[model samples]
Target: MLMLLAAGLLADPVPVYVIAGQSNAEGYGVPHAQLETIDDVTVVWPGRAQKEVGPLQAGWGANEKMIGPEYGFGQAMQRHHQSPVVLLKTAWGGKDVWCDFRSPSAGDFNWAEQQMKTREEREGRSRKVGAFFNAMVDNIEVGLHQAQVHLGRDDLELKGLVWFQGWNDYCQWPVEEAGSPCGRGIIERYPHNLKHMLCDLREALNDTTLPIVIGELGVHGSDVPKSRSGWALRAFRTAQSETASQLDHCCLAPTASFWDTQATDHWECHYNGSAKSYLRIGRTFALHLLALDALPDGQTLKWQASQKGLQAMLRRYPPKSGGLALWGSSIFRLWERAPAHFSEFEVTNVSFGGARSWETLHYADETLFPIQPSTIFYYCGSNDVNAGADAASIAERFRLFSELTRDRLPHTKIFFGAINRSPEKKERWAVVNEANQLVGSYCETQDGRTFVDLNQVLEADDGSTRQDMFLPDQLHLTERAYEGFARVMREALEQKVQSP
Candidate 1:
């Protein structure tokens, strides 16, 4: 048994993919089959954590991007690789690699454009240097830091980095010519600018050997008329293909397939891909990143079936069930784990499996908000190690949960439990402990909401060891530990019931 355990320690971790870029890369070109589910993956909204009912934000914001809330690339990679594959997505909408995402409103190229415009007016030529390059380095550095918080203190062995940009540069054709953010006129110099952007990104990340999948821009066919240069949007596809040629780890994925296959309005930019095309975009991207380049000889993907046009937009799902819970991979038989009292409550164990906060909050509605569970519990925050989020996020999550409880189970009392402290797991996990304290304080101020002290129970009376609570990895829980949490939760619920 000792030898077997030692051998298992040598096994490699599950592959994980990281994706970034501008809005198109963030899922703008191809919205999911439903606005909520992208590529058969669900978007876990963050708001449901507290009590207010609001729209779900795509990708990770306060919380790290989990494979569940973002069940797209992560799930597909895990399935194809036949192992767990965690996908870390930090793409920003309308954000250029050449701007500061920390500022939120830093995409103000108008300032950069104005300086360049005045220079051009004075010198009769485009400015020789643009600040886009330096700005991108900051973004890349910040992005790397954010990834590091979730990734352990080590050089994360990255498998792939999906690229869905160049539109900003391509869009410049019209913008720089028209002198605006939109297509005003055509600037032939823009595509070359895109190449510069790509090189700058590769250099900044020092990731020359990493595999990258480039996604082309797609219009819903109702783009501005240009029987000639008007359709220059299509040329972006060619440019992406060209960028892939120069980069050893780069390849291109045509996104016209993200279009709606059901033949909805071709004018709708979101539903613009055929289903087969969408799957290909997802599957082939994963395959190439895994070094399966020889399969596609002339740009054809080997999917279970071929899809074309509007007919491809149709999608199907295995109906929701209660028989078995879903793991992060969605394909693996996951070991159940949590912060406190997961098994004791049918509160839609939304903590693990990295879901969008919104998805985690609302998951119970599909599971057992009304059917069972007197109070809901959620605890996850290490994802916010940097870019410091305020109590507003904790408040927002609590507010959403409160609202959801009122809507689903009006009589139900919602309890906001603090995130637990990971003693010796990843160093960044310490950040989650700080956020958890805030959550505890935040919940105490609420009326129907009660903040439970999970830490006190897990820790020894003197703040020492409750050794049974955590596993050897320090990330997961031991069976006795899960049961201990549940037992303590039962006592808490009993107290709540007696109080009111």
Candidate 2:
């Protein structure tokens, strides 16, 4: 591994990608079954700027598999840009979107363990999540360190963050409310308290500009729960896009029909996904990360360490020991603007993989709100491509996304992730590409936003989309695809664009 410092202090910014959120992002993937050698090209993350890498390492492992979303995007990017790509995996196989993994150090684990054991006994099974609880924090803390060590940078040095959650939420969300405050032990806050977690995380990392890409979670079904499906999962998956839209530096990848199965060593009951979908999801988010760093003119939200925005907001609360400020979540530490003062922003992603325009639009309205972000980077219409949807439908989707952007943000960037082509019998690649062209063309009529034709840029010289560019099933691009996608955004941002 070429060290970052010795490789020459990144003349520009290091193309760092954070792989966060639940299982899919953290990797419940099955390692490839065979020991067949592909090539370094398949293994390398994007941004390396060179191809013809040697025979690749054996990705297949007994306890695990390596075919996940980031694989391709990372390879393509490294080859394309000569930039080092650091993927920090911070996924907890089964956790809720709102649950912030709490540490034992944060509270008394004995009480938590006792209560947990009591419940397990009542249910005639041992429900000790203590291992999972500790592992979650350990994974993130270690993953953050991995990024730091690999990227060789402080706070603002890393590039972007990718989030793939929802499955965990799908399994637990229904019952979460029943278990209030998690028995008052150390509690991982919920999405309802998302601001606390996000704001605090930003403060801790000191990277307000960190682009966060959250993959919409879909419960295609998992071994964890037989009933972890149906309306609850469907509705949550539909709504997850909103969570992504609301947050800055965050984008949502459609996971509606993206997963396939293989075996894994992580959870005894969970099977690894096709890994290609994971690869595509990773790439989807990476594209936005690259875009955030690439855009030259985008304004960034700055962090305030000293009491500037919080003091005013806190004064409304009752003063106990020090002041009302002390009572509020400490994340207010760097929150410069009061909630009232913070700009009301909006974002709507205009594309989908397997989802419909109406379904996506509906979820956008319901799930996305109180969004921290102003503009949405929409990438959709893939699944629809095979469904006989025309360019008009694609155009309509973009239009709907734009309108939703207007309603929520009132003032924000509404960039579109160019919906690319799919060759499945159901999806006519040519027509889908044309629809993307239409969406790009139509977006010109909108304001504070632009359409990025990442698909055009992602194509190989041969005119055929790189096979390694997508999953074996061929619905989406692999990790390299996301890397390629991100590079396009990087190139654009390097030139100039609007930002939050």
For residues 313-395, write the lDDT of model 2, one tens digit per residue: 33454223211110111111122332222223211122222344443443443233223244344555664555566677657
Model 1 Cα lDDT, one tens digit per residue, 1-500: 56644544565643546555544434422234443432322122212243111222233322223111133444445554454344544454444332222222223344444544564577775432334345445544554444434433224355567765554445444443334533322223333444555655666567655567666565443244565345566565565556665555466654453444464422233333232333444444554454322222232222112211111322232222322122111101123554233444332332334332333342333233323344554443332232243444534544544544453344556655455565653355445555566666656676556665556756787877577867775645567655565566557667877874
Total clashing pairs in model 2: 58
Q: Residue 454 lDDT in model 1? A: 59
lDDT values of the candidates? 0.44, 0.46
Candidate 2 has an lDDT of 0.46
Task: TM-score for candidate 2, please give it.
Answer: 0.44
Give per-model CA RMSD: 20.2, 19.6
After superposition, which runs of candidate 1 have C-alpha atoms over 4 Å from their true positions?
Answer: 1-9, 28-70, 95-155, 172-187, 221-230, 261-280, 292-500
Local error of candidate 2 at residue 28 (angstroms): 3.8
The TM-scores of all predictions, comma-separated, are 0.40, 0.44
Give per-residue lDDT, candidate 1, residue 59: 33
